[model samples]
Target chain A: MCQLLGMNANKPASLHFSLAGFMCRGGRTGEHSDGWGAAYFEGHACHLLVESRPSANSPLARWLHEQPLRSRNIIAHVRKATRGAVALENCHPFVRELWGRQWAFAHNGHLKDFDLPLRGRFTPVGSTDSEHAFCYLLEALFRRFGHTPPPTPALFEALAGLACEISGFGSFNFLLSNGDGLFAHCSTQLHTLQRRYPFARARRIDDGVTIDLGRHNHLDDRMVLAATAPLTEDEDWTALRPGELKYFRGGQDLPDGVPVAAPLLLAV
Target chain B: MCQLLGMNANKPASLHFSLAGFMCRGGRTGEHSDGWGAAYFEGHACHLLVESRPSANSPLARWLHEQPLRSRNIIAHVRKATRGAVALENCHPFVRELWGRQWAFAHNGHLKDFDLPLRGRFTPVGSTDSEHAFCYLLEALFRRFGHTPPPTPALFEALAGLACEISGFGSFNFLLSNGDGLFAHCSTQLHTLQRRYPFARARRIDDGVTIDLGRHNHLDDRMVLAATAPLTEDEDWTALRPGELKYFRGGQDLPDGVPVAAPLLLAV
Candidate 1:
């Protein structure tokens, strides 16, 4: 098992506050201590930092917590290494380039016997079911859309369908982002929180640190956060139902693009 | 023009000492103050850090100089923004995945009116002639070798030929690596230094910092370093001829895979 965290903001924002609490799950509060990774997207480029060490005490992670690397989209993961060796390459949030955009993906749950054929186009650099699944998703998208990117709605639909199909193997809870949007899919467990103009006080669940969210945010700033578990105790975190997919862009949730009434099946 | 630095080692070595001097060129010693990047390969995974700020004064770069991130292969660049805006995406070294390995490339010189048609396989996320040339090289390699990577000799030959073709547009000095090997191409300026058993005192050219290399290294430790200019004051650095390509693996130079007598011409 692993813990995943994602953030989408209307303006370039730092994940330092949330990351401080979330990273506690890597060793202090939780058992996901094998490895950890974080990806911060600045336009089309990303700063991807990963280490095969517990983030709770890693000097690099500590340095990262102090630095305010602002980004519109961010994804992070702390791994427990259920599927692959505890190596640097197996650390999540894995990244790939698709349609001239740098895409990042991170998984929170394990997939059982998830062996899918890759079309030799977006192959995995690491031996992890999560990476294999990410490659499959990219390959499927490339095969369907060719060189040009489809509209956002169409992409959301295709991704929802793919997520549903992949969930059939096992738990496939994941968060994916390509700088423009952040997509989160729930297989068993996932939570979301929204922060806007009327922000209030929040308290960290891992440590008893209190912070006035209003002091750090501007009036126009809007943001959405997704995590496997709630990082703050005071915030109202919404739990997504199983097999649900949510899309967020510019810190606001887009209308439910996937039909929620029926189960999605990727048409081959 | 930008500045390039690369290292290939027989062991997982830290580039902190050399990087300390090399990053000084970002603003302290030279005028490559647009941006800077560094890529360190840990097996198939790469820690790619890029900032659209001068490395000499950047806090992140300062932290990096203090940390000992060990790797067998490393590439770093200080950008001057010859053909692209000073953005994070435009910073080197650029990275892409192919054949289950992460390949990193950094270019030092500018390409004049270099617009080549991409085959829609590997696309450039950033708008730079350097990235465009990198994508062209990858696409050409994929077209020639398909999914499976060719032998080292074949790959060296293919890359040498591609380097020659790309250099026709302008100066294209570059350093490329896929963890297993480091390939350097010289259009007008490139220098290499070999350090092995009999290490001696070395002084930085940018700063007058002197260090006894033998005190920090073991007898079996071997490394090959590539830079646009000699980083140290008292090292015997070899200058590669124009249109010449050099391949290195395990910190040692391989035989001239391409015939030195005749210039390479990539067949369409």
Candidate 2:
């Protein structure tokens, strides 16, 4: 189907090992060879790259593997087209702006009867359900709070509620962020791992590569990793329970009992 | 938050216009600025690139905007860390393999307690729940049908079921593929658009730029684009329902009631 990879850490880190292995699915080891994309966040700025070539064996993919790109937060994807024809416009890892803050998103499932609603202010450039969702979410946010972002707890509660509501219609596993925190929700199959002190050696299942976090990462740094499935052989990954959503900041989950914001309707 | 952009067409297409606008979110217009990445799919492979720099002004991002990279399918992402420590190891759009096919995925949400019981067969190289979920899906597919991929209908049904099972945890919106077709699921936010005859000049919502797709695409070629939000200023984007999933092949949805090999796992 598709694969997703995300990392949250207390310090700058590189996804070279994970990306190297993930690239194999672009063309070498598998056939999601539609296109690939990735994003890395550095404070209020980000670096983005996109291509319509397989990542496993593509020159670009190879170069990236050796480039050792680093960031405190990152999101990457390889695509297998579901809607949109196999064209550059239909790739994954879409980015947008809401309340002057940058937001990123990637998806792994499909939706039914997804029609673009003519939401005021926010509109879509491409023709995909993923974009519609993003627009809708932001439109709702803007509708509820105008230009100011709500408190983290309030925002989280609202987002979680909206996510849960959206999940009822179809599969809605996704990863979202706003430079302040990373939010993840699993509808069907998603997993996560937190790496703290005592990092260990990990072997990639797709490419059979191994790396020790202790050697690669600073010991004091804490990290959280989430994906559709496990990619390493040595570490333990926890699967998300049905209808569960979590927020991470500095690699730690936020406490519960956050006040929820009022729901905003999609702009039409 | 995170963003994804994708294009699928019968022939290769470039994402210059869309990407140009998306890059602004890295730092110029928005803030998904943890990192940036993109990939292209050609035949049975993908070409990938990632940079841990601000895409809005990154030399590489600007180069890509001017350099036309063409492909039949594409994927890209911009990230803001909420989980794993800020590092390259925690990137989105993780790729993997199963049944001798490459698979790619990106996410825009977070999963809680996503650490699932992962066997040594499939593991995560990064520390994102998104990758873990991807591996689990592949592992289940491999386990269900062994090495040889099942028929398309059978495979779709199985994967769809798996998607539903995982969605129970949280939001499970995603896009998946194996060179044959694309599978997408919506848990919260997802959008899709199809462009056929009567192409028009579309403007980027993020960058205030415009492009005439009719000049770049052929009358005979149709395309579908998916994203986290609409990139263009004027376009219709369908929003995915909470629990909806679908597949697209050559810019068309799969016929309904096509003997799905597995039963829809409602319980999951």
Candidate 3:
């Protein structure tokens, strides 16, 4: 499978520092370098870039590190294909339009016997379980909500339910967004961390570089990072409880009617 | 990088049908076909499997369609190399031990200048940015909180701050878990969907097959699906806002102090 990385903040910020080290996983220190891509949200709109090449070698991924594309949310991916051909079309994170908004997604697993019928409203431009699932999700969203977007609470509720049904087919771990906030689900593995004031200098496990976020954002800025694993070497990343779910935004977890277990502490 | 697929629910469910359609994108219909892997969470543990081949052509992906791996949470991925040579050692959803919990992660983007040093507490066996990030994150968490766990609210706050700092380097979108509810982030692109009672039959966009989730889930059961895109033809899928982050557990968004913008309704 591939890897996932995300960030949600209370205010507009740049992921350049974190991304500097994170991108190295594509071809430098790691080996998932099939392709690389990323998105930057500015208000209600998003800017996206993708390359069907390794991040370490891809000039685009390199530029991304240097460019200070500011946004409150961001999604990026590096591929090691298992479901589709190694082409630009199959590279993630995949994007589409729904409820009049551009939605992006990326997957980290495979499902069999999953030849879904595309009803046309949302079609798969690429042939990958990740893309298929993305199109299917959009189709379902259009059919149910049409052009009118649902309230956040209600929409999150419905999405949670749908995620459960689809995950039943196989290991379904995913990251989703629409330039608003991120939604995540895990079947086998997933981890998360939030950063805010009183920030500390942290080191990258992929690279020995360290950064002090405290030097960047105001005390009010808060951010969240959910990944298949932790990204820093001096911060606390929590593991999701099995069969659990929650929602987050503006660097804070939203309150909902779901029951969640207390987080388990991992012994380092 | 690889793709990720995830499902969360209130009850045990199988991803046979949905995963089957998604697998097509791995090689037959999509381009991620370097390799495929998936894991189904059963209680606190997970059932894992992988194949260093196209999911569409891989017998393992096909067998998964017929084999009913039941779980409330699932994680899946299809590789499209960006780093190490195509091999199982480079495959994702990468798992590790933290605080006695198995943590997993999948990445979809690349990092730059990600050369980092480690304390050897957690070493990445694979040469992927995803793994390096994971090991770094775990090491950081252990360094910060040690064997004791912090409160969820505090933990989220710290993680979010760190994520933002790291994201500054490059695109970082990801899904993470420890056999529990999932944590996802969006640096550029990613989307999510939630489903619950009053569910109905839905079609897929890739293979044109349909499944009535209503037949599988109880009226009261809630499920969440997070992906690079939507999965159904008749539902609402929300996009993660740029620079946005979130957490999911149960069937609702967790309440946090951070500000969360409504779903983007920008014209397509």
Q: Write the per-residue lDDT of candidate 2 for residues B10-53, one digit (tens) a residue.
A: 66677677778877888778788887777666555454556555
Q: What is the DockQ of each candidate?
A: 0.69, 0.03, 0.01
Model 3: DockQ score: 0.01
Residue B121 of model 1, lDDT score: 83
Give the per-residue lDDT of model 1 (tens digit) for B220-252: 999999999999998899998999898877788
List iRMS for all predictions. 0.9, 16.5, 21.2
lDDT of 2 at B71: 68
Which runs of model 1 end up more than 4 angstroms from their true locations? Answer: A257-268, B257-268
Evaluate fnat for each of the predicted models and list the values in order: 0.77, 0.04, 0.00
lDDT string, candidate 2, A92-184, tens digits: 676654553557787767766765454434454456676567667766767676656788777877877777766766777888876666788
Winning model by lDDT: 1
lDDT of each: 0.91, 0.70, 0.70
Question: In candidate 1, what are the lDDT values of residues A130-249, reduced to their tens digit?
Answer: 999999999999999999998888998899899999999999999999888899999999999999989979999999889999999999999999999999999989999999999988
Tell me each candidate's RMSD, in Å, in order: 6.6, 19.4, 25.9
Task: Give a tens-digit lDDT track for model 3, residues B172-241.
Answer: 7777766666767777777788788888778886788888889987888887777776666777878888
Second chain TM-score, each model: 0.95, 0.89, 0.90
Model 3's C-alpha root-mean-square deviation from the true structure amounts to 25.9
